[model samples]
Target: MFTGIVEELGEVTRVEPGDGVTRLVVRGPVVTGDAKHGDSIAVNGVCLTVVELSGDEFTVDVVPETLRRTSFDGVEPGRRVNLERAMAANGRFSGHIVQGHVDGTGTFLSRDHDGLTHFAYPPELSRYVVEKGSIAVDGISLTVAEVTRDEFAIALIPTTLAATTLGRNEPGDAVNLEVDVLAKYVEKLAAVHLPSAAVDNGGGEEDR
Candidate 1:
């Protein structure tokens, strides 16, 4: 698990394509300071296992499935990405729980003068987002300031503007988004008691 607290902004050093997987090397001295092989790192909200480590760089192999599901489909060198090391067992849980699993990609729409930034999310995820709910955008934990059927807004503080990848994101840029897992769990658990929901999942006498 990750805390969605971005430790540093990492830069993609290389992207090598192979038959089935692409090798991605990122330079993050802070996150890779004590990193070892097989450690998990969050790259723009996507959990990736470190396969190799160098001086200030770590490498991970990205499978096709991950590529298709994230904004990394055609990611290239020199792109700045949010980086966070997995939370330590004894570390303080400063932010909400972040699985580093990107649920879907959202589009950066606009940032107003007041730092109210808006993004268009997938319609299916609409139900999980609520005002004041927690959401991870490109691995940085943020609270929802407003929500609509297909979009949500976050109030970005000055620190967020200067520290993470969101600062450099342009309009229409794709960002990885992960909604609060607890909300999803609540929905799933509540579905069991909702007659229509049970039927939608093909539940019947056998399930009861």
Candidate 2:
């Protein structure tokens, strides 16, 4: 798991395409300080494993499915990525739980000068978003400032504006998104209980 706290803004150093997987080498000095092979890292909310390590750089393989689900497929060598090492057991839980799993992608809509930023996502994902709930946008943990049937807004502070890839995102740019896991759990539980609930409410045949 990740904390959705971007430790540094890393640059993509290389992208080598294979038959079905792309190998990405990213330069993240801070995240690579103690990194080793087989460690997990979050690149723009996508959990990737470090398959190789070099000075100030680490490499991860992105499969076809991952590429299809994330914004990384559009990235090039000059692109910047939000990099975060997996959360340590002893680390402080400063942010909400972040699985580093990109549930879907959202398009950047606009950013107000007053710090409210908006993004448009697939309506199917709207059920997971709620006002004041947590969401990871391009790997940064943010609270939903507002929500609608089709989109949601979040307040980004100055630090966020300067620290991550979201700062450089333009309207229509794609960013990875991960909603709170608790919401998904709740949805699943609700679906499972609905039938029983209906039966309890006189919808079931009476027991002989």
Q: Pick the candidate with the highest lDDT.
A: 1
The 0-to-1 C-alpha lDDT of every candidate, in the order given, reads: 0.91, 0.87
Query: Local error of candidate 1 at 138, Å?
Result: 0.5
Candidate 2 lDDT over residue span 1-208, tens digit each: 8888889999999999999889999999999999999999998888899999989999999998888888987679989999999999999887889888787889999998888999999887887899999999988899999999889999999998899988899999999989898877766656756876532232321111
What residue runs in model 1 are displaced by over 4 Å at the alpha carbon?
197-208
lDDT (10s digit) by residue, model 1, range 92-141:
99889999888889999999998999999999889889999999999999
**Given candidate 2, what's the lDDT at residue 162?**
96
Clashes of each: 0, 0
| Over 4 Å off, model 2 | 195-208
Question: Candidate 2 — worst ten consecutive residues by lDDT sum?
Answer: 199-208
